[model samples]
Target: MGIKNRLKIMSFLQYFIWGSWLVTLGSYMINTLGFTGIEVGMVYSTKGIAAVIMPSLIGIVADKWIPANRLYIILHLICAGALYYAASVSDPTIMFWVLLVNAMAFMPTIALSNTISYTCLEKNNFDTVTSFPPIRVFGTIGFILAMWAISLFRFELSNMQLYIAAGASLVLALYSLTMPLVPTAKKKKNQNWVSMLGLDAFVLFKKPQMALFFVFAMLLGAVLQITNTFGNPFLHDFASNPAYTDSFVVKYPSILLSVSQIAEVAFILAIPFFLKKFGIKKVMLISMLAWTLRFGLFAFGDPSPFGFVLLMLSMIVYGCAFDFFNISGSIYIEKEVSSDIRASAQGLFMTMVNGVGAYVGSIASGKVVDYFTVDGMKDWQTIWLLFAAYAMLLGILFFFTFRYKHEPEKLANVGVKH
Candidate 1:
């Protein structure tokens, strides 16, 4: 098989592992294992905690000691074991620790997979900018397919999702041995610990505009986490109502939630046009407003015919809410930062968003969810409206606080090059 095809398969399976459990696990924990919102949030927070520390440490190991492909294999192997053990865990505290081990093993593999892919592409003389996106899109497809598989097979509320993830992780680990070997970088005497750990990127905080952008990036990251952590459980809650018990939304919430992933693929194609026309500030503001709409629609949505329309709209807007800030923010960082710290800056962006932002969001959103629960029944409408209001407030603040002039010609080149 061609290298591109091989890498596509790798990308697919890499995310397939995550897709198996990420969306549905909340429902499983809540509905089957009888865990509370705070407990589930604490479990999910493992990903945030792992994202903060593991990637940088793992990057150092891959750069100086282990080949990226080899490290990827090792991480997936650990993930397979951790996830398999997680399936057998029933106690919330035990499950938290089990999933934390899994998260630590799994989170770094994301960056390692990218590193492996980039190395393979460059060695084969492929243009990473042009070639990588198509290959990466398969990962999203893998995610959607996994969600559908869990829902269709009635594994959404079972431990089978974790087993499936564990099996996939094992397969990917074995398959990774076949990929082209990525060589480690030789240690440089001049490299400082701050540079190695990506702490040098913190210098961007000195610039007021960049500092404000990072802050908002972290806030938006929290929104993303809130959706991921609760969206499935929210839809699954509809099954409690006899009137909506037979509806497709209740019968297969993950499949319906997969629409958000499908929409994500479509919206990514629209980003260049939006960025070119509106610039980063306006594009980001649109993202914030889309997030507001996403939550507000969910606030009113249900399994009823008309309410179902609102549910579908929420799914559609998720693509805009997600990709606009994430991809656009990366581009903004690329354009603004110097070449020396560019890579570090990107790493810091992820740390702020996925690490700190996700941790805070998970914990805070969990508390919010619990606050609205009485007699074991949740006030989902009020919960969603409060989230919507938060997004709207962020939009308002971001509009006034962030200042950047749009230069069409400068960004035009970035669009053309990508």
Candidate 2:
């Protein structure tokens, strides 16, 4: 098989493992095992904690000791074992630790996969900028397929989802050995701990604009985690109402949620044009408002015919809410930061969003959900409205606080740098 084809397959399975379980696990924990909102949120927070701690440490290991492909293989092997064990865990605390192991093992592989792809692509004389996006799109396709597979097989509320993810992780572990090796970086003398840990990017905090941008990034990151950790469970809640039990929305919630992923793929393509036309400030403001609409629609949506339309609109707007900030934020960082700290700055961006933000969102949202529950019945409408208000407030604050003068002509150079 061609290298690009091979990379595409790698990308597919990498996300397939995640998609099989990520969206449905909350429902499984909540509906099947009768776990509390706080417990489930705690479980989800493991990913955020792992995201903060693991990626940089693993990156150092891959840079100094092991080949990237070899490390990728090892991490997936661990992920397989961790996920397999997770299937048998019933205690919320035990499950938290088990999933944390899986998260730690799994999160770093995302970056490692990209590193391996870039290295292999360059070695094969392909332009990464042109070639990698198409290959990466396969990952999103794989994610959607996995979600459909779990939902169709009726495994979304079962431990079988974990088994499926474990199976895929194992397969990827073995398959990774076939990929070309990626060399470790040459050891450099006198590398300080700050640089070694990628903490040097903290210098960006001295500048108010960057400091504010990062603050908003972290806040939006929280928004993303809130939806991810709760969206599936919220959809699954409709099953309790006999009036909606037979509806497609209740019967195939994951598949419906997959529409959000579909929108993501479509919206990603629209970003470069949007960034150039609207400028980053306006584009990001649009994203913030889109998030408000996303949650507001969910607050009003249901399995009824008209409500179903609202649900679909929420799924569609998720693309705008997610990509406009995430991809655009990365582009803004790349354009603004120095080349020397560019990679580190990117790492810091993810740390703020995925790491700290996810952790805070998970725990706090859990408390909010529990607060809205009485006699084990949740006030989902109120909960969603509260979240919508939060997003809207962020949009207002961001519009006033983050001041960036956008240069459309300069954005043309942003893509070229890659």
Candidate 3:
């Protein structure tokens, strides 16, 4: 098979493992295992905890010792075991520890997969800028298909989802050995621990603009986890109401939520144009507004006819809310930082968004949900509205605080170096 097809299969299985369980796990924990909101939050927060340092730490090991593809295989193999163990646990605390181990092994693979893909593409003389996106989009399709499969097979509320993910992980682990070997970075003499560990990326925080950008990135990162942690559960909550008990939205919330991923593919195509025309600041601002709409629509939406429209719109706006900030932010970081520390800088960005942001959001949103609960029933509308208010506040503050002038020449020159 050609390298692109090989990479596409790799990408597809990469997210398929995650999509099999991520959105529906909360509902499963809530409905089947009877875990509390805080418990579920902590469960999801395990990903954040692992993201906090695992990626950079594991990255150092990959760069200095193991080849990327070898490390990728090892990590997935470990993830397969961890996930299998996670399936047998019912206690929240034990599950947290199990999932944390799973996250440590799994999160690093996300970056490693990119490294492997980029290296393979460059070796084959393909322009990564144009070629990689198409391959990456397959990952999203894989995620969508996994979600549909789990829902259709009624695995969403069972341990079977984890089994499916583990099977995929095991398969990927073995398949990864067939990938083109990515040589480890050569060790330089007299290299200190700081540089070897990629901690030099931390120096970017010395700049006021970069520091502030990361701070807000953390805040938005929090927003990202909130929906992921509870969106399906919120949809499933409607099943308790007689009016919505038989609604299609309740029966296949994952498929409905899959609409967000579909919208993401479309919006990702529009990013280059938006970045060139409006610059990163404005583009991110649009993402913030879209996030506001995303949550606001969910606030009033239900499984009813008119309300389902709102739900679908929320999923559509999620495309902008997610792709714009994440992709644009990465591009912006690439523009501002030196190429030498580019990989480390990207790691730091993931740390801020997925690590600190997700941790804070998961914990805090859990408390917020619990606070809004009365007589064991959650007030989801209020929860969503509060989230919307938070996004709106972030947007307003970002507008006045972030002050980068749009420079078309700089953006136009991007990717030319690569």
Instruction: Give per-candidate clash totals.
Output: 0, 0, 0
Off by over 4 Å in 3: 30-38, 122-127, 183-193, 334-336, 405-418
lDDT of 3 by residue, 1-418 (tens): 9999999999999999999988778878888899997788778878999889877666566666777889899999999999998889899999989998999899888767766776787678775545666677778888989988998898878999999999999999999989998876665689888777657678888888899899999999999989887887789899989988889998888889899999888887787788889888999999999999999999999988899999999999998999888767866776676544545566678888888999899879888998999997999999999999999999999999987888877665554443
CA lDDT scores, all candidates in order: 0.83, 0.84, 0.85
For model 1 the TM-score comes to 0.85
Better of 1 and 2 by lDDT: 2
Q: For each candidate, give its TM-score against the true structure.
A: 0.85, 0.85, 0.90
Instruction: List the candidate 1 regions with Cα displacement exceeding 4 Å.
Output: 1-3, 30-38, 60-67, 115-131, 178-193, 196-198, 276-279, 330-346, 374-377, 405-418
Query: How much is the lDDT of residue 17 in candidate 3?
Result: 98
- Top candidate on TM-score is 3
Writing each residue's lDDT as its tens digit, candidate 2 over 222-326 gives 999899878987998998899998999987777898999888787776776787788889999999999999999999999998999999999999988988887
Candidates 1 and 3 compared by lDDT, better number: 3
Q: How close is candidate 3 to the true structure, as a TM-score?
A: 0.90
Per-residue lDDT of candidate 1, residues 48-154 (tens digit): 99878776567666765677789889999999999999999989999999999998888878767766766677678675444555676778789989988888899
Model 1 scores a C-alpha lDDT of 0.83
Alpha-carbon deviation at 325 in model 3, angstroms: 1.7
